[model samples]
Target: MSKNKAKKEATEKEYRKPLIKRRKPNRSIAGDIALYLFLTLVAFVMAFPIIYAVSSALKPLDELFKFPPTIFAQHPTTDNFSDLFITMGKSWVTFSRYLFNTVFITAVGTAGHLIIASMGAFVLAKYEFPGAQGFFKVVTVAMMFTGYATAIPNYIILNKLGWIDTYWAIIIPAFASPMGFFLMKQFMEGLPTSLIEAAKIDGANEWKVFSGIVMPNVKPAWMTLIIFSVQALWNNKASTYIYSEERKTLVYALQQIQAGGIARTGQGAAVLVVVMIVPIIIFVFSESQILETMASSGLKD
Candidate 1:
């Protein structure tokens, strides 16, 4: 009867315990407050430029050149944006055409770069082959040179291939960009080889292993690569190669307005906002994916 009573008491104690235990913070409340204050200051500093740009875009011509440029507009107006649209309406090439060209190029180029780079990175990271190390070394060296350094060579090759006036000149080069491939390869190296081998042991083919297993595991890396690729392609003017007015990007159109001297100063500020907004939006939306760690931890035994 005593043993039975003891068992009943133990059961009652277990039921009384909380299901979830909360961890105690290592830092005191004062420390946490100080840390948050410092972070807020850093964030404000970084966001200052973007805030200033928006303010400038809203400022009228007179306020824009005021002594000691202000971070916020005194009397904000949409005149700059309205004037920008009016000026764009005067261009021979329709604004929609420029928008379409940019969207198409950016979308196609980013997609192509992601797929091709991911595949190449998969091969380099997972498989061993003759000259693999040497090939990766070449890619690492290639990344050191800026696009300006390779501009002439790219033009010459495109000219030979009769792609000078065509979209292929830009899109093709983007597919072969070294940055995405390098990033993906580095990220993929951290993925567990055992997970891949397990997939293979289940009779999965190479493509299945790559598309199903490897790609999903390296989500953060590719999302970052997308941001880089989009930023590069979105800002590209293609002036050196693409001569046709109809083939020009939205950036080229805005740049033309920006060069209209002091008369178009307000419009020029608006142009800066328009050009930068798209990439900023893309980055904001994908930031979570970029920061997320690989999902391999849960899959482990």
Candidate 2:
């Protein structure tokens, strides 16, 4: 009887194993479904504005001000875009020039930030110089201050240097960024010290070690800095560019479209849509690569 009881208990335990395994899989599937639903909702919220802006830009003048707000334009026209170029039968040649100016400023500013920030961060992370920790602490504190607070001082300095209304006014001030330095420093700190030591053992100078070994390893951080710099310069508004009428960015140009009153509403929307496309395209193409590289680097580390 005791042997039969033991056999029965063994059979019951065997049946319970399958039930436990099935419960785990069911719970995992439910969790995955919940996460997907949450992500889908968030995506829609973010995409709605971009979709609306494009639709508004394409809407005909008659349908632009409709009461309920039409989600789709019945008649799309390119007339608004054409009007931006033509002013009283003669082309406003300055439009393209201003666009190029913005591009140049953004490009130079982004590159400068990447090089300077990465180098500074590498030094702070690897070197054991005196006052290093204190200096880094100061940088962290400086980052907490908004750039707008220094606009007046920046403008005055630029004015002293006769840089107002020139590309220097925009580009020069952007190079001194504390946030980029901080981010790069944090990333550099996480790099394996053995790599730096190995490079030095081979008689590589400090610059060689930095460029040949450290920079390559921190590609993700570098890409992140590029994205940040691009976005910041692209959206900058609180500089002399705000005060100077002749030297206006694409953002300022878009505002001018509204100066003609309510009849030109469609044109204003078109100008906004055109200006927005470049940044959106850049963000879309770079964001995925940046995220993937960062994820892989983190996993490897």
Candidate 3:
């Protein structure tokens, strides 16, 4: 009797309908067209500068100097890029050396910032200790000030430490930047305490919990942080701290070409495109992760 009742209830349950039917949004053809047009306009506006830079880089000297300057080059050529290479080849220091300095500084600074910021954020987010809140408050306050505001203090400190004219002058300062710390801590706050506790219960040590558990979950935050750190360090000229020509960056070398009074105009245009390339590529690949991090950064259990 009980078996028959159970089978009958199961049959009845199989045919039950959902209580609430999902409704499609009401459609408006005119509104849809208008919305699409607006989005297209905005995207073009945002992308125009990048397009213009590429166009300018391809333009010949005559076209570049034309009275009514065009957005797109009529006769696109690679002469500008060729000239840039030739000019770089003629420099006192090899272009490759300047490139090495920039790449080395940017890579070291970005990696250091990522590791230090993540560790600091992990401690602040997962553990409670004396002066933690106060320290974070200091970090928040530090974020409010721009690099220009702190330049003098940085120079003085670096000078005192005798790091002036060295890579440490720039790389060390980048590691202490508060932007990554603030961002990572906020995003990590949304991670559940119980998940971390569970790892601990399994006999995972602090380093294991942080490396195996915490870091994997905060991918978006750190990826976005990489973009910011790379952009800053890659573009930095460090003119004030490092006076050595060999120690100067690619940007500083390119800026000399740019200031060469009308003769290197095309090469200068190519320089702009080259400088923009790395950061743009990095951002494009990580854009989705960044968007996810931004959207869910504030949500917590």
Candidate 4:
């Protein structure tokens, strides 16, 4: 009877347990607060220029020229945008033409860069050739030299090719970006070799392997490359090769507006907002996607 009672007691104890337990966070509350504060501060510092532009875009002339410059506007107005369009209408060249040029250059340059960079990176990462190692090493070293360093040489080459003041001047030279190639090569390295081998076993040629198999896999990397290329080409002055007023990019036109004097501060601020919007939109939407893809790309079999 005592043993029977003991078994009953044990059964009751086993059935009386909770389904889940909550553990305390690994970090102390104070530490968590400090970390959040630091991150917030860093974000504010980085976003200062954008915040200033947005605020100034809404501010009146008197507030914009306030002795103690403020980030927040007191009175908001859309006069700057209105005045900007009016001035643009007076110009012989259409404002739409400037917008079209920027969009066209950015699109063509980005697409060509993606294709060329991906192909080059694929070869550098996967294919073994006599001088492939040396070539990739040279590319890596070349990235250390900024684009301005080669501006004079590029001007000479473009002049000789009869591409001066032409769309080709901007589009042609953009295909050879070493940074894009390097980024793609690194991302491609993380891909599984078995997939490529399996594609080959199925009678897929080099082009098929690169396009059908490889391109689909490293999407995040290329999407990231899109972000970089868009930002670069969107802001490009094309000042060196492009001499015609109508051929100038929206960025150059914005600079011209900003130089018109202190009276156009609000309009210049409006210009800044317009120039920054596209890249910001691209980044905000794709950043989470990039992180998720990078996580999955690390899985190997």
User: Which RMSD values do the candidates have, in order?
Assistant: 6.1, 7.5, 5.4, 6.2
lDDT of 2 by residue, 24-109 (tens): 77567679899999999999899888877788788877788898998877788776777766741242537766576677888999
In model 1, which regions exceed 4 Å deviation? 1-47, 65-69, 291-301
Q: lDDT of candidate 1 vs native?
A: 0.87
Per-model TM values vs. the true structure? 0.80, 0.78, 0.86, 0.84
lDDT-superior candidate, 3 or 4: 3
Q: Write the per-residue lDDT of candidate 3 for residues 81-160, one digit (tens) a residue.
A: 99998889888998889999999999999999988899989989989999999898888888777989988988999999
Q: Which scores greater on lDDT, model 2 or model 4? A: 4
Give me the runs in candidate 2 sitting further than 4 Å from their true place. 1-42, 75-77, 87-93, 238-246, 289-301
lDDT by residue for model 4 (1-301), tens: 9999999998876765432222443658899899999999999999998899999998888888897998898878887788788887787777788999999999999999999999989988887889988888788789879999999998999999999999889988888887777788878887889999999999999999999999999888887778888999999988888999988898988889999888778889989898999998998889975574455333222
Cα lDDT over the full model 4: 0.85
**Local error of candidate 2 at 275, Å?**
2.9
After the best TM-score superposition of candidate 1, give how far the Cα of residue 282 lies from its true spot, in angstroms. 2.3
- Report residue 94 deviation for candidate 1 (angstroms): 1.2
Q: lDDT by residue for model 1 over 1-301, one digit each (tens)?
A: 9999999999987876643232544657899899999999999999998898899999988999999988899999999998887777778998778888888899899999999999998999889999898898888889889989988888899999999988888898999899778778877888889999999999999999999999888878877889989999999988888889999888998899899988888998898898899889988988876665223212221
- TM-score, candidate 2, is 0.78
Estimate every model's Cα lDDT from 0 to 1.
0.87, 0.77, 0.89, 0.85
The better candidate by TM-score, 2 or 3, is 3
Off by over 4 Å in 3: 1-32, 296-301
**Cα displacement (Å) at residue 99, model 3:** 0.8
